[model samples]
Target: MSAKFLQILLIAMAATFSGCRNNSGDAHEGESHEGHNHEAEAKSEAKADPHAGHNHGEAPKFQYTAYSNSHELFAEADAFIAGKKAAILSHFSILPGFKAVEEGKITAILTVNGQESRAELSAPTRKGIYLFEITPSTAGKGSLRFVISEKGGNTESGTGEKGELRKRGNYEVIVSEVTVFADDHAPYHALQPEPSAVNTTVFTKEQSWKIDFATALPAQEPFGEIIKTSALVTSSQEGEAIVSAKSAGIVIFSAGVVTEGMSVSAGQTIASISGGMADNNPAIRFEEARNNFEKASADFERAKLLSADNIISQKEFTDTKNRYDNAKSVYDNLRGNFSRSGQSVKSPLGGFIRQLFVSNGAYVEAGTPLMVVSQSRKLTLTASLPQRYLPVLATVREASIKANSQSPALSLGELKGRVLSYGKAANSDNFLIPFTMQIENNGSFIPGSFVEVYLKGLSGTNVITVPVKALMEEQGLFYVWVQITPELFEKREVKVGRNDGRSAEILSGLQATERVVTAGAVQIKLAQATGTLDAHSGHVH
Candidate 1:
């Protein structure tokens, strides 16, 4: 090849090698870009926090020493000693309400037992307590869990022998009533929205027991009043006597027969039947004999007259007269019921016919069932009451009944029942002790319909009551949620009372005025169950 041609080939080969290297470099750069993007994403995710809300970030805590006994309460209107508090309360501190230090001196004034006792006032402590115990003053172990600074911040607190009021940091508290318990292990572990306020649940029975949940409201906060639902009742009835058919057989037709419940006059035939008609009414023979006897009787009468007039012998007259007597007897018996097969049986009383067993042109035999006669103008609702309610029934002075046929059974109803009879045999349906309620039905009540009853007997003074839905239960423990913040719900325990079967009674842990979770209680719990929320895990004073 020529020298010039050789040089041109070399140049072309060099250019091709350079092109291959550039392509390889471009491919590697694409993969490197993906790796860089992935690394950036990972960094962003790691910097974020899941538990951001609970990051109390070295929040000040106070220690609690004194407390109220945490005993359980049972039975209605039970009271607890004022000083007893729950052991769950861990610390007590006078967490500085406020020290108006005009020029830098702890110029705070703490009045103990109505006297100016010295205050070891200091900064807010780092402790958590169930409650606070007042100094051993004539206040009689009085407990104050919070204090207020002239400013506006609130301080959480507990019971103590002598409170050490502080001077610095956030502060404000208005201690109110303290909870007392009967048994330490009461189901008082109810959930609440705020840790400060304790609320209780009323699982069953009206006002059976009380849970002592002191509120943080001003010492003299007025309690919300209570009210009772109407009375309890059963089915509506017309008359006292409830009757049923005793025999069973094929029904027979009557002139004006109808099914059960068709009203008819007293004389109107409720039911009827021509029994044994297929066998040829035996009474037919008696009727024919009766006719023959009638003819013989006529002949005998004429013969008797002849005998008297000497036209016939005495023996003949006597024989004819005897034959007339026999025939007459037979005819008289047959005349009363010559054709028993077609004889009509009538009712004896005057009332509406309630039930019938026969139809026209129908045949029945002996002992066949006819129809039932009901004396009841109305009906009564008989209920099988549970034995657990025995005591409640007796103590009740009055009761009312409601029809259970409501769209969704509830406290509202047409309460129009009264007490009729009580202490009957067991009910046929539930087999519970029977309680008869004579419901004067003006036709509003049907005999076979079911109903529900609400009985309000003894009542206490009116107090604020919360809806049962506002309450929450977990692991046998009951509680409520306070709408502390728009999106946050604090879990707290409460004690409750009488159940209207609609709303639950609040005994303690909640204030009547405090707004609670009307719905979505479970949702709040699920959020808390993850320990994402301190829930009841942390301590409360």
Candidate 2:
């Protein structure tokens, strides 16, 4: 026989003996005499074979390991040896970039004691995995090399080394173990909080110092229904006044630096008009009038002396006196105002420079406005409400005003203010009723600037209210942070009712006495999105 055929025959005979031993005890237990006879025949066959009674060495044992890029995909391999046959079971998952190998795509090379054997892949009970069997000539430590061919001509290869096998009296026992990689257990993906789940974010004492976090308790307070409307900040006619040019000339600013919003005192010379034609310039006209007045004065003195001496007629004396009086009146009018420069404009009131009508070098006609001075200490807030609200307008017990800047809104109860007046009838142009409230400006409120007015009515009892700063919005949904513990917070969605610019009324989702984050809410929102919150034991408030 050929050497290759002899090797195949030896392997087949070994497998036959292994199968007989497993079946012998079961069949012989039913009949003692028959079982004895069968055992005698098995012993005769084993004695006849030279390799039957000899130890061929231990059966091959395998250690299977698994690995994957993420927990979504898991890979495992089970390898063992039963009698003379070495079997390998490879399990794969269809992940994002990897696919399962087909029946003919797997090839394994098993090497034992310097001898190598190749086997074709076979299907297993489960899908997406494969199995194959190999027959080794001798028993020893073995290594399995596997190559899986992908449909796109790519290949994946792995090696199982230091594999051993052991044998028992009747059957070969195969042992397998598995291992997995570490990086698949990432914290962010593994420990994400569900949207509807109550998740507490832990802020350590050390981390809390880095953030400006503040909390306030929701309490039962007198919350009133607020009517919000746009309003205009204006100065009363008596509280504000404008400085105008008395004569037409070029405007020259008196101060080195003059701009709108600059504070000015009453009777202060803000600017002067100079450089005009002789007829228009008050300085030149005053000089000509003074010369005429000197001549008139001399004539009047002569007339008076002649009248006393009876050498001049009464009519002549009266005419001379009248001309002298007119000249003197004209000179006196120009004396105090005339200078080399021209007419000077003084501020009518002590206040800020509200407006500058003309530039420094610009020319102005007589009576042209130079600048507006306003006493900002007292101002008016005028709001136009829909005609339908006129019924409730009478019930407005308090009001507040908020500018479009960072300054906090001024509450009427804290500051000096009251509703001055309301229109008796709706305006014909906009069909909206106008209401006015007087306020003390306190240096921050600017005239003519638009502001928001909150008209609060009678307060309602047993209402939960929180500071407006405690609320945050995401995708049109309002939420607030409830302190679950001293250093932990949980986000909660809330339904909001009327807001009075300072405090907002909560209709749902919060209880009185529960502490909510009034500051640093944005920081907590960002931490929640990235899953950077540390884990801690927290109790709900």
Candidate 3:
């Protein structure tokens, strides 16, 4: 009872002084009185001291997070008290893209003691934020909600896709429960504030909307065994044609310079053979054939009439007709083809020039190969697989192909592709077995270019997977950004199983419903280096 009694008395006196200072400004002028309840004040101080982590200058704040088909709402408001004014801060963000809502009407409704009060804001003080002030007339447990409406009905419900949400009208966003106390001196007046997450990175809607940012939910998809290998893109079996010289002569390209990869059409003259003063000179040969055809025609006409009138023998008419037919055949063949130049070399098929066998002005013999034109509409993707894969080659039914290292892998099925053939055994020259797939070009693939291919088997199992772009690497460990809230993202380390050059199978460390950053993941990783941000930075209360 010696030192302890003195310490207790001093602490009680100090608490009394602090309470008097807090209520000094609330009293009327000259209305001071003496009989105060020190025990009640001490009990209130003890309850409030445990929540000193959060600022409680005047009143406590309550936070609620909610989501709608169209938008996400995160709201914070002052604790409800009878006849006291409350300030509410609401943040709105659009879904799918998670961009801030630039324009809208946000209504905050508070229902307490069988009565309702509302505060409305037509526009935001800042983008994505709306502040509301309301007063509660009575105090009790109540429900609070927000109704959002926008003009022109342009707001999307989900993904902005058709049938995802109501084509027109406003919607409500559901949030956490609401509690109203009788007064500030209630039993549950104060509580410890939530600690900020260390690993959660904040990517603001303003920052995300400006860049190429997007997110997608992880999904369980059918994934098959992948045999990764290199492939060669080549023309299909009937997609290539070789143009040959019909007659031997000096080659002259038609009009402009002809080069490899130049587009050509069937019967289109790509070059001409000039028989300058030679035996194959089409100019001289054409004239001779014309003269011979004129003589043969006159003789055949007279022979036909004479044989019918019994003026000539049947054998003579037959001989005349044969000569006429032979002369006409040569004339007709050279008629359209012959000119000042020897003969026109025409492409047999419409395609790009894959190869030019002979240069301009080069002499070539009859039937000499001139060029190769490929109708690249259909292409063959050939992959060389080791002998061990031969056993599973027959089970392979589809392929995923990347035209180049920078391109995303395209599905063979989507390209109207199918397995053409596969070698049962490895060839003697090279020990690797060849596997070929026929895929429609879709104007995306180039012939003779090497590509990365993933040969997929017929059997598969459903597994969680994400696009390969979503995964980031750190010291050989793969990680992806998983969005916990609209703006808060947590980096999760995952064990990658199989990658088909497009989507990767996540063996662990992820949930199917969690949305992951499919694009602009690097931006978030860079933000992590900068440091974490207070998610509630712009709060008004």
What is the clash count of model 1?
86
lDDT of 2 by residue, 194-231 (tens): 33335666553234334675565686877666798989
Q: Which segments of model 1 are wrong by more than 4 Å? A: 1-235, 239-379, 383-413, 421-435, 438-454, 485-488, 523-541
Residue 300 lDDT in candidate 3: 95
Q: 1 or 2: which has the higher TM-score?
A: 2
Candidates in descending TM-score order? 3, 2, 1
Clashes of each: 86, 5, 0
Ten-residue stretch with the least lDDT total in model 2: 166-175
Mind sharing the TM-score for model 1?
0.31
Please give the lDDT score for candidate 1: 0.43
| C-alpha lDDT score of every prediction, in listed order | 0.43, 0.67, 0.81
Candidate scoring better on lDDT of 1 and 3: 3
The CA lDDT at 385 in model 3 is 86
Tens digit of lDDT per residue, candidate 1, span 270-332? Answer: 343333443445345555676789788898989978988999899998888888888888777
Top candidate on lDDT is 3
Q: How well does each candidate superpose onto the true structure, as a TM-score?
A: 0.31, 0.49, 0.69
Model 3 residue 350 lDDT? 91
